[model samples]
Target: MAVTFVLAFGGSVLAQEQWVEFSSPRDGFRITFPGTPGIEDVTWTSQMGYALPARVFTVDRGREHYSVTVADYRGIEKLGIAKSQSCAPGAETCIGGQTRIVGPGYWKSDVHGAITYAVFMLLRRHGTPTGMTWNWAEQVEGTLLQFTNADQSRTSASIYMHDNRLYVIEGDVPKGTPEPELFKMSIGFIRPDGSGSNIYSHRFRISAACAAATLSASDRAPASRRPPGRVSGARTFPASPITFRSMARLPTAARFSRTTGRCQSCGGAGSSR
Candidate 1:
């Protein structure tokens, strides 16, 4: 029998780290790890007795274990895919349960409920979480949840839904490991077809620039000033909306970082909430 041991988080001590590239053609992701990772296929059984198939890639370095799990929801029904809402202009919120586009193609989803399901799954498998917090990243609009197990192992996970698949990138490290943030940011999706777009980032950048311009052109007194994005002058924006390349071509690193929440070298923000 294989011996099982709890890799205590408190005992993790850093040594010299060697970074390597690990790519998953089956799951469509590529990430940098301290060493070559081992792969395994795992089954996640839901509370309702449904089993979801998942592929996990894990690497163990000094005091940390870097892992990425890609879960397929093609036939699973527990976490239903989210449908786009067509809301009225004056309505506060729209009705849900519209027919969800179900297929192998990935769709952008609201990740709040999916994150909740993930938490439940974690609880079912590993007992109660010692601590938890929510986080968001630009472009993909994912939810990063941090958890500590009773075994003193710390798990920092970010869940993202793309193309009808759920991607969970997790780092389990000892409590005092340095640069945990960088470990979390090392995960990235590898496009098989090389065709993808960050629609949310594009919209956010355009709106942010428009809001800044409106604020700069505001004429009202401080006390009576209206909110930004309500400029009164004639302003012309591009008929063709901004693209990710344009966002990349922004003047400086700091300015681009502000828009996309990513560092120039690493390609994204490192910290989770």
Candidate 2:
């Protein structure tokens, strides 16, 4: 009976430690977790007051909680357009009209501010921030934050924006537990072709250059294989047209390399950190 008990306990420990890579192809991201996570669809309110579709994937191991929240800002431009059109004609609010509301690239601004907005939200939580810094994962720019809760628990989080999707990856554990570095560092971005990468040469900001590269690649593909009127791994702006001239105005360099399956600007040679 003693030997049987020992074997059962050992097996349980091993099971608890079994970590796996989980991917969300639709969301275009992947991460590691101790176990499969529960996914919940949610409506996330942006700092700009837009109600956006989002998903929260969570896993709980003993006292530790790990989660990844992905918020889609795809339809924000449409929302802005509607809001602008609904305003009374000639009113102060409608002074510049749709051009004022949606045209100044407000959607682009929203995407650029996503990571900072996510960090701002986290700062308002119960924990007191112990550290905050600009960080990167797989050469993708992000913000890293550490906090201490009232109950003395520790929380570590990384906020990243890729292809207009905001990702908030967090891990909360009991007091004195080592920082959840594994969970934080295991994030990878998936390409439209369903491939993922965790390596890059240098940190890169989310920019139109990368988006244009992706769209250009799709355009070059055979029509039958190409996704109609949409760029894979990117949100399509139907209400507001994106001119290639405007895309060129943004900083350039990143390109998806067909042979390497990595960002050419990222150098595509460095090992995953």
Candidate 3:
């Protein structure tokens, strides 16, 4: 939920766009948002008249050895497979950062092979002439296991994403490549003070992730300015718009004080009118 806001507001969301490779930060090792591998390091330019995608939220770690990220693309959701595979995740398991089975589903992409497992998105191994691409959101809880068969693999790098951001967390686990092992989670952040932080350093990994949000009118603003998809994952949402109002745009000043029942949406996540 928090990450959703970061992307929508930080400048990534738009009417619907394509992926753009980020520049700068020189060069560094890339991990699958291992914490939440997704696309980042973007920038927003004012030359477009309106806010455009511009910033580097997609994080890479390890100091210039590799690159991993999460990318947003198109996909499909199937149901019958859930019956055959039988890994329906319940409410208790939805919390961020824990290990649970999602569905016996998979993410099939032309880039990577069929990364089958128990989750919503698939982490395809789509390597290009320059680098590799793996798309999936970061796991809040329940590790997302990506198993291989034997040794003799071609690529030495990878990436992943969850919610809406990508992460770089996994390393070349040569020892347990084929076996069913838990996927490693990580924590990366852009703090309120405009600083960067990776919550999941080499010492720790995320278990179950939880992000709270205010999901009301959203479309009126730039998509990125909103938040990540709903945490609850409701397929259907009310068709409304979230508008950004400027004080100067108002015809007259309608002033009031906090003590006199002023601002309407002023409280945090829990309070209400």
Candidate 4:
């Protein structure tokens, strides 16, 4: 999706700019930005105290700021193993018997708790959290937060974890402006082939291979026996009733309206289709 802006002066259109879709295959995600965004590589310290690699893609339109941060957690298990190996003999800080610095499946826990940790960091910002809720975009579960900044600017943020990568998306605009829902809604997970996961209605699932690598013996229990909200390696997600096949039959706007119960373009707050 694209947003076009035209500047008019004296009844004449002077200049135009477009918000174009930007895809980062390396980062495994895509989003729309007012222009090409600046990319920066940085080290991110996870809540579990592991130094992970991260990248930030940002674009500024006047006073408004938009950014998506991708933090890679793929190497966390290795880091945990190294920490455990480096622990002193009979160290009290080691968990799960004295042999490990961290518990079994600690990386999985870290990945699962990423969204909550990211949301906590956002809440710590110099802003008042006006609203927060569990939200899903393109079938990926996440948390969404609305904040009123100290300067009265409004900010909307969403955090999601997919494929062991944590995504933090934020948009801040001056007060009284409509929420930057377009930027927020445009987030899409990308495949290696450059196709977007958003093109289909499917829930994010951890593959059996990933489960084999990450799940500890205790985490391999039956889904019913496992604790609620715990990640299950073998669990299967039910297909969404609203499939792309059915949506393709409807008009574009009608499809979005059917899914959201509101106009996609206007971002209004009514149940009108």
Candidate 5:
């Protein structure tokens, strides 16, 4: 699976930014934050009267608040493996005494239902919603819902299921927050041990590869060719060989730009070429 990264940029004005890795051993996930985020403990009570211990990692930058709320479900697996009747009796390949099966489609459905209900409850707390939209995409492997409360404040959330945990990426920003969808989709769930999950490993690998590619292109210039006190100028760097076929399945607004020209997103003068 090719992971697509989305970044929301407001106006031209930029702030000092630094990206760092934040890992939560308790939650069994890690993510990159633009700045150091504060951690808070909270309780998430489900509709079944089960109180799930959760943690919220948040950072407030200007008017945008980035938060990743992880609710661990290992104590009680909500969407867990079940016996499959299709397996032949006494087959050596049987898992846990029977064929254990759990499909991604089912996982998405269950997670989406839970998230949509939560959104509705939140709206009720703040009065009727003036507008709202619910979305689910297989390509993205997640469900995203956006709503505007009676107060006009916009809150968007993207939910993803990994292992026995639910990752709720919540983004609360003013209407001026640029590309709100980008921020909503930016919350990534990294593996605690970087094993047992190809998606987690793949994401980190892509990030490393992209960073290396950028640095490699910059170092290609010889000392004599580089102007004094000036970073290397833009040059043709071999395009990333990685191709995300699934991203092509996404809407135009969420797909990647496959151009050798200047990066339209950042206007980097051919930096992304």
Candidate 6:
């Protein structure tokens, strides 16, 4: 139910609210504000054909997200690559065309969803308590960009920057693009006009509520063993399971931190027990 945003921030300032290039793996990504550092790198992989994505949030000391594999459109819905124009497909026109906002469920604290596969999601703030529609069917450079929109119908920006001027590319979230998979069930299908277009995937990732990360034991370890024939150092965690109980209810040992005068906030008033 929590939607997290993964905004790109590597580019030269263009005009007012745009930039000339973008932060990308192939293109080299970087975001240097007083905020968090850039991610050292992102390594995504699939398990049993399902995705088990993991990445570090170098931007903030303690932040992370998950991702999955989804499809792209054109002709065949499975491979995810557009086949041709004669075969108008998912999220084609309706997604690219201007539409009226209609859905009204963003009033909640967290929101996440997908376009076609109905699972990719973002934070609740990205939507309106009411929904909207879109009409973004425009052609640029021979590659028809099926404009994407939310229930609010706000057109999606290319999310990339290029040249002295900002550029917006339209299409499926570009194959292999990383996205959270937590909300892959709340989105609805909308091919109001079969010819317009639709977008969906077998699976997509959605960000969850940002919580103070409890140090997972694996975080302390470096990359574990990898699969046969796969590149080394992809940094996947072992699929071990463990549980934690609140220290309050169970009688526990007392400890102290020389730096902070607190016991990890387990006490009633967060003072010495």
Say which candidate scores most in TM-score: 2
Clashing pairs in 1: 9-174, 106-163, 106-164
Q: What is the C-alpha RMSD of each candidate to the true structure, in Å?
A: 14.1, 11.2, 20.9, 15.2, 17.4, 24.1
Q: How many steric overlaps are in each model, in order?
A: 3, 0, 73, 0, 0, 59
The candidate that wins on lDDT is 2
Candidate models: Cα lDDT each: 0.49, 0.69, 0.28, 0.65, 0.48, 0.22
Ranking by TM-score: 2, 4, 1, 5, 3, 6
Considering only N, C-alpha and C atoms within 3 Å, which residue pairs clash in candidate 4?
none
Worst 10 residues of 4 by lDDT: 237-246
Model 3, position 241, has a per-residue lDDT of: 21
Candidate 5 ranges with C-alpha deviation above 4 Å: 1-21, 77-113, 125-140, 199-273
TM-score-superior candidate, 4 or 5: 4
Instruction: Give stretches of model 6 more than 4 Å off.
Output: 1-18, 23-49, 52-114, 117-120, 123-127, 135-273
Model 5 lDDT per residue over 202-257, tens place:
11112344434333433454645422222223433333322221111122222123
Model 4 ranges off by over 4 Å: 1-17, 92-105, 198-273
Write model 4 residue lDDT over 167-212, tens digit each, in one string: 9999999988888889987898988778876432222232343223
Q: Compose the digit string of candidate 2's lDDT tens values, residues 93-155.
A: 432334422332244446557788899899998489999899876657799899999999999
Q: What is the lDDT of candidate 2?
A: 0.69
Model 6 residue 136 CA deviation in Å: 4.3
Error of 4 at 60 (Å): 0.6
TM-scores of all models? 0.49, 0.68, 0.24, 0.66, 0.47, 0.18
